[model samples]
Every structure is written in structure tokens, then in C-alpha cells.
Target chain A: MPQIAQIAETYASQIFWLLVTFGFVFFVIGLDMVPKIEATVGARDDKIAGDLATAKAAFARADEIEADYRKRDADARSSAQHLIAESKAKAAKETEAKIKATDAVVATKIAAAEAEIKAASTSAMAEIEAVAADAAREMVAKISGASVTPEAAQQAVKAALVHG
Target chain B: MHQFAIEPLFGTDHLAIGGYNIAFTNSALWMVATVVVLWIFMLGGMKRELVPGRWQAAVETMTGFISNLLTANVGPEGKRYVPYVFSLFMFILLANLLGLLPLGLVGLHPFTFTSHFTATGVLAIMSFAIVLIVGFYKHKLHFFSLFVPHGTPVPMIPFIFLIELVSFMVRPFSLGLRLFVAMTAGHVLLKVLAGFVINSTNAGAGFGLTVGLSSFALMIGISALEMLVAVIQAYVFALLTSLYINDAVNLH
Candidate 1:
């Protein structure tokens, strides 16, 4: 019985720890372990979020640089187009001026030629009148077969005019 | 090595306290020792910091297990009961596992030695009772008529009443017995196996080694099995407690 009692004592200690464990578990429940767990999870979540924020910022920065380059290229291309159009317009204006200047010179030459022809026409008409006068006088004298005095000539001119 | 034997509750003479026989049992000693050890463990862990040592981490794991259990099973309403559940789980878990240790009855005659003085007695019974009482107390008047379902036929009500009553009365039994039987059986099997090993070792020269080795293997296996059972029984106990509470609160 003494030996048996001693053996029970050995097991007794084991049972004690068991009871203690039970008490502890129960106490933990009473103390509200849920919120503490939440707090732990919350802290972990915050850390992940912080990391994500950093990653996002870096990504945004990379995107911004890419967008900046694209914008600059677009601007350059449009400006180059604008410059090309301006040059084309200026070239057209210069070509038009040169053509108008050439047209004016040609018009001036035509006007001078027209004036010279008018003067020549006037001289030719004067010569034709002088020749016609001489021919007519000589024909009249031949037809009359006499030389007449001035008064007689006048009368003869009158007669010839009446006869013609 | 000292041999173990079971001592009866009363010797040839009875010890009387208020007309009830009292044995200054190994049970009382074990209970006190468990308290002291738990207290030490708690104090060791309670200096909660971001970086915890091994013991603290282990304690925290236990706490976390119970917390998650409550959150998963009983809903957040049972969130406030974390400590109680945790305490319940730890107590039952360790108590079940305690049988694995070398605590046995000691005696003079080798034949007289037997295993006894289990922790599963008054302490476990009382703890479960306290849980039931407190659970009901929390629910108050709402706890009564818990068996009576909201709607039933007038004629069939009595039959339902009896069924419900029986089920209701069976709650504490199932809850308490689950732990008691599981712990007791696990320990008893280990003891029986140990007896066989001892007997075999006493037989022959080379046979001792084989028996010892087999015993070791068996112990290891039972240890692992008991460990699982410990947690499971605790879970069942806590789960039932919460279920009863839920029943009281809903009481349709």
C-alpha cells in the first residue's frame, strides 16, 4: 500500500499540471483573446499596406516618365508640322510675287509697242495725202491742155471740181 | 524504482469530515501543483511583447488557438469568452495528457500495485458543473424553458417536452463524460500496455530488450494519440458550452 501510495503521488503531479492547463485556457477565454488576435492581424495588414503604397508610388513614377516622353514627342512632331506648313506658305507667296512682277514687265512692253504703231500710222496717212494732191493737180493740167493764171486756175479748179 | 499501487478511498478506518469520508488524495495535491505550474507559465508569458521567447510563443499559440476557435464556432458573441474557453481547453488538454506520465498507486507487494488516483474526479466534474451553472447564469431567466421549442401541436407538446428535456439533461453528461472517458481510457490503455511490457521484461534475457523497445514504441504512439485527443476533448467541451449558451440566447 505504501508503494502504491507513492506511485499515485507520481501521477498526482501530472494531474495537477492538467488542471492548471485547463484553468489557463479558460482564463484566456475570459480575458478576451479575440481583440488581441485582431490587433495582431491589423498590425500585419498595416505593414502589407505600407509596402503596397511604396510599390504603387514607384509604379506611378515610372508611368509618369513614360507619359512625359510621349507628350514631348507629340509636341515636337506637331511643331515640326507647323514649321513645314509655314515654309510652304512663304514659298507660295514669293512665287506669286515673282510671277506678278514678270506679268507687269510684259504689260509695259506691250503698251510701248502700241504707242509706236500709232505714231507710224499717223505719218503714213500724211504721206498718202501729199502724193494724192500732186497726182490730181498734174492730171487736171493735162486734161485742160493750157497753163492758166492764178485767177484762171481758180476758175479752172472750180470748173474741174464742178465737172468731177 | 518505486512501484505504484491504488489506495482505496477509506482504509479499514473511515476518515470523517462533516459525516462524509474524506481522503487527502493525490487529486488535491495534483490540482494544487497544476495551479502553481500554470501560474508560472502564465507569468512567464504575460510580459507580452512583439518578440516573444519560446515559452511565450507557445502560450500565445494556445491563446490564439482558442481565440480562433471561438471566432469560428461560437461567433463573435463568444469573443468575450476567450479566456474561459482557453482555460477550459488547456485544463482538459493537460488533464487528458497527464495520464501519460508515471503517476500510479504505490504498494509493498508487486502483485498489489495498481493504477489509481486520477485527476478526472471531483476537479473535472466540478469544473464542468461550474461551466454549466455559469453559462445558465449568464442567460438568466432566458435559460429556463430552453427545452420548449417555440411552436408545436398541443397534443404532441408533451412528447417533445420529454425528448427535449432528456436531451437537455444529457448535455452536461455528454460534455463531462467525453473528457472523463477519453482521459481515463487513454491512461488505462497506457497502463495496461506498461503492465504487459513489465511482465515480458521479467520473462527472459533477450526478450526484455524487445519488450522494452515495443513498450517505448507503444508509449510514443499513445502519447501522440493522446495529444490529439486532449485538444479534441477540450474543443468538444468548449463547443458544447457555447452551443448551450447559444440555445439559451436564441430559445425559439
Candidate 2:
């Protein structure tokens, strides 16, 4: 086996080069390259975590905004409802007051017309009595050829009207 | 055996220091190749995008795998050892896989440095040394208590301690030997099967049909298995190293 037989001759060379090359690898690759790769991986992880947190905050803000909008919408709707009800009540009250005033005016006009009719009826009865007295005086003169006074004729007509 | 032979890339005496021949060899070439491959692989992930491409994801998966392994084996304190363990794991894994690169089809032989005990022994020693340094630095002499079980009877303590001490001392050798032997055996088996296929085909058509075809099929299967072994060995080396570190850190 040359490996065993040639050891005395090759050991030095092998050891020398092994140390030189391995030393380069340890310093250049192990010490330097490894850390850089790990740093890149670490930075990527941090970015992902940060982005996730930002998304979570944004989502929460959106939910809050939606809730606020809904609340305001409900408030606006209720205020509109309150305004509608208030105006409806005010219009109804105004209508009732106008109807009451108009009702009182109409009642006064009707009473005045009734009093005027009663005065007209009283005058008409007086005129009819006078006409009846004159007619009676004429009729009595024609039938008996007696000349009677107007007041006596009126009295006779009033007695006959009382007996009838 | 020729595959494992380590010929100096330059002449043998080209580079020597302190009287030790440190000539650059094929094994050294593969070590450098492993580093280059690992660098390229790591470069793919350096794009540093928030959404990683496939290449970047592959690199991150490997690092994350090692990180998780340390966390599971060595607890929180295991974090400090990630670079060392990651380097060790990737180096060994790439070396093992590169050796099985099927470059033989192109007439290029890939050397598996990890198959050599000298290479694996060095890695095992490094891990063992860390364990020793961490244990003593943190616990002082109390690190010796690692040999004695927590609630041993006084009479049984000495015998148990001896067993534990020997096993503890065997860790580095076992760690190194396991990877070396596994890699060497698999390569040797594949080579021997290739030899059988060639020899059988040269012998005759009947032998070639029976032996050569079967050996070739088995070689293909073992090659697939070797790929799996390559990954498993690297994982085991890292896992055992982390577990050993766990002992030094937790004292259990």
C-alpha cells in the first residue's frame, strides 16, 4: 500500500497544503461569506414581518372607518326622520288653527242673515194689516150707503178678526 | 497502489524547510483543488439577494446544515466552532468526492488525500487538540474527571477510569483511521474489480461474458455506493468532531 509506505515522503507536503488551503477556506468562505448570506435571509424575514404588521393595521383602520360611516349614516337617517315628524306636526297644528278661525266667521255671518229675515217679516205684517183696513172701509160704504170713518172701519175689522 | 503513490510535483528536493522534504505533490494539488471548488461553491451564495437563486440556496443549505449540526451536538457554545467545522467538513467532503470524479475516463487520475492517514491524522489531531485546549482552559484539572463516570462506586472508579481514559485517548487515532481505511478500501475494491474485468476479457469471450460483465456491473454499483460513502464519511468526521467537542465543553 503506497499510502502507508510513502507516508514519510508525503506527509509534509500534504500537511503544508492542507493548512494553506483550509486556512483560506476558513477565513474567506466561513468567516466572510456565511454571515452575508445569513444577513440577507434575516433581512427578508424582517421585511415580511413588517409588511404583515402594516397590512394588519390598515385592515383595522378600514374596519373602524366602516363602523364610523355606519354610525353617521344611522344618525343622519334619524335626524331626517325627526325633521319630517316635526314639520308634519307643525303643519297639522297650523291647519287646525285656521279651521277654527274660519268656523267662527261663518257662524257670525249665518246669525246676521237670520236677524235680517226676522225684521223683514215684521214689516210685511204691518203693511198687510193697513191694506186690509182700507179695503173694509170701502166695502161697508157700498153695501149700506153709510159713510164710516177710517178708524171705525179699522176697529170693526179688528173686532170681526178677533171674533173669527 | 499506483493511484495512492505520492510523487513530488517538482523534483523531490525542490522545496524543503528545516530538513523536512515538503515537496508539492499530487495530494497537495487536490487539496488546493478542493479549496478552489469550495470557494466557487461559496461564491454562488455571495449574491446576497433577498430571494436566493438555486446556487445561493444550495450554499445556504450547506452552511445551515453544519450550523444545525453544531447546535445539536455541541449546544450553544458550539457556535464558536462553526468556521473550523465548516471548513473541515467541506474540505474533506470535496476531497473525497473529487477523488471519485470519474476522471479516469479521460485518463486523468484524481488523488484522494483523505485516504492517506497522514492527512486524516492531521485533521483528527486538530480536533483532538481543540478538545484538550478547551477542556483544560475551562475546567483546569477538573478536565481529568472526564474519565470517571458521574456516580461511580469508589471501588469501581479506578477500573472504570482506566477504560474511559484509554477510550478517550483512542479518539484521535480512531477518528483518523476510520476515514482513511474507508476511503482506501473502497478505492482498492474498485481498482481490483477493474483489474478483474480487464483480465477476464483478455482471457476469453466466455470468461469475459461471465466475469468481466459481472465485475463491470458490480463496479458501477460500488461507484454509486462510493459516492454515498464519500458524503457519509465527511458527515461522520464532522459529527464525531462535534461530539468530542461536546465532551470538552459539557464535561460529560
Candidate 3:
């Protein structure tokens, strides 16, 4: 009963202190601490997000660089191949031209050698005709006991040679 | 027991001004002590490390717990009410736990502020006040529709509304009585059981020793339960506050 009665008597003081303490705690935590904690949490989250974005951007940039490098490498390889093909074609054309020039020079030499041989054979034949005519004239004078003319023998020889 | 008795700590001749007892009593001292402890705890835990230390973790855990409680009952819109809800939960929790600590001033009883109906009554009324004020402020006349059940028959509407009204009216008293009764009951039971051990120990030699030891063991068990009760009661108070606020905001 006294406990019940004392509640009313001390009600005002209890409330006053309660208000004072509660208000103090509320403001201290509500205005100060809670917001501070929230800010920290928000900041941590933002840091994580920013770091993740940076990482993603770096990854994308690396990919682009690699692609560019691959393209350049392919271009260099193709150009090298093209250069080899062109040089090979040019070398073949020069070899063909050299062979053609050599063949012309060889054909000219063959023609000159044939003409010299023909001239030499013609002179030999003429010498043989003169010797044959002299020998015939002497044989006739000695064996037949009639004096024949050298000019006539020569003409006869010419005629025989021409007919043969 | 004289544990519940209040006496003036300072200001001789029983400081009274305008018929109001303005004496700084043991209750006031304990209340101040509770507030100071809270202040130190909050201030000490103010360091916001990426990896929180023990003190910081404790503060964050407590803040998160209350945050979750509000969100669960009051939904996303209850974000603004965190400070008030956090204040009530921590106040009641600390008061309950502190009273159980066996720390008392010379010639004064160890007590909890939550064990007093005056304190819990004020807290409950304040929570209820927020509901009414915010509800009326938000919903205005439609706030009365909270008593009406949605899609009720015309005949049963009156009965349901009456029941709802009564339940609403009893919210503050129920809230106050729940904490007071729980704290007071547990404390009284602990006192009685401890008394049993003392009395039994004083009775005889061998038999007294046996009874005393067993009772002491039982008392320890009860003390553990009382600690759990302290936490639960704090949670329940905050949870109900959130629920009531939700009811007020989102009506029937």
C-alpha cells in the first residue's frame, strides 16, 4: 500500500528526471551518433562501389588494348606475306629476261660459223679443179703422141665437173 | 521490503517547492547513472572503423537490432523514427539490466527504473502519444477507422469496433504493466528465493547446508532467466511501439 501511495508522491520527480535523461539520450544518440554511424556505413558502401567501377573500367581498357594489339599483329603479318609474294614475282620476271637475251646471242654465233664453213669448202673445190686439168693435159701429150691445147683440156674438165 | 522506498539524497529539510518533492533520490541517481552509461557507450563506440572493434561492434549490433525491429514492424517508412525507438529500447534495456547488477548506494536497494510503473508508464504513454499524434496528423478523421474491421457485416461492425477501441485504450496501461510486473515479479522472486537460502542456512547444520546449496543453485538459474527476461521485455516494448505506430499509420 505504501509503495502504491508513494508512486503518486514521487511521480513528478520521477517524470522530471526521466524527461531530462531521456531527452539527453535522445538528442545525443539521434542527432549525433546515429547520423555518424549512417554516414560511415554510406561512405564504406560508396568506396566499395567506386573501387568496383574502377576495376571494371580497367578491365575494359585492357581488353581494348589487347584487341588493338592483335589487329596490328595481323596487319604486320599480312604485309610481310605480301612483300614476299611481290619479291618472288619480280625475281621470276628478271630470270626470264636473262634467259631470252642469252638465247639470242647463241643463235647469232651459230649463223656466223655456218657461213665461214661454206666459204672454206668453196675454195678447196676450186684448187682441186685446177690440179685435175693440169694432170689430164700432160697424160694426153705423153700417151697419144698428138699435141692437144691446155685451154681445150681445161674447158673439158669444166664441162665434166659441171655435169657431175 | 524497503527496497522500493524513496528518500532525499541532498538538500536538507526535505527539499519541497510548491508541494512538489524535488529531492534527488536514489531513483534519480540510478537514472542519471543509466544515462551516463549510455552516453559513454555511445561516445566510446563513435569510432567508425571499417572493421569494427568490440565496442564499435556492440554499438552497431545494438543499432542494427533496433533498426531491424523498426523495419520489420514499421516497414521502410519507419526510418525517421529510429532515434526515438532506439532511445526507448536502450533506456528500458539498460534500466532492467542495471537494476539486476547488485550495485546499490549505501542504505539503498538495488532497483531498475523499468520496474517502476511511473517510468514505464511515461514511456508507454509517449509511444502511444506518437501513434495518436502521427496518425491524426497523417490520416485525420480516418484514423478512427482503425477500430473498424475491413469487410465486416453491419451487425458485427459495432462489436468489432468496440473491441478494437477497448484494446486500443488499454495499450498504454498494458505496456506499462507488462514491464513493471515482469521486473518487479522477477526481482521479488529472486529476493524470496535468496531469503529461503539464508533462512535455511540458519536453521541447522547439515540439513541447512544442503537446502541452502540447492536453493542457491536454483537462484542462479532464476537469475539467468531474469537476464533473458530483461532482453525480451526490452524487445517486446520496442516491437509493440513499432506495431502500434504501424497500425496508426496504415489503419484498418
Indicate which candidate wins on lDDT: 2
Candidate 3 regions exceeding 4 Å error are A1-5, A70-164, B11-18, B48-52, B104-108
Clashes of each: 40, 0, 0
lDDT of 2 by residue, B1-252 (tens): 999998778847668777777888888889889989999998998898888899989988888888889999999899888888988899899999999998989998899999999999999999999999999999999999999988999999999999999999999999999999999999999999999999999999999999999999999999999999999999999999999999999998
Number of the candidate with higher TM-score, 2 or 3: 2
- CA-lDDT, candidates in order: 0.59, 0.90, 0.84
lDDT of 3 by residue, A113-158 (tens): 8778887778777766777778777888889966668778788888
- Model 1's lDDT to the true fold? 0.59
lDDT of 1 by residue, A1-164 (tens): 33334543334443444345445444553354434644554565677899899999999999999999999999999999999999999999999999999989988988898888888887775565444445555666789866544455455555665577
Error of 3 at A104 (Å): 11
- The alpha-carbon deviation from the true structure for residue B106 of candidate 3, after best TM-score superposition, in angstroms, is 9.2
Model 2 stretches with alpha carbons more than 4 Å out? A63-164
**Which has the greatest TM-score?**
2
lDDT of 1 at B115: 24
Better of 1 and 3 by TM-score: 3
TM-score of model 3 (CA atoms): 0.76
DockQ of each: 0.15, 0.51, 0.37
Worst 10 residues of 1 chain B by lDDT: B107-116
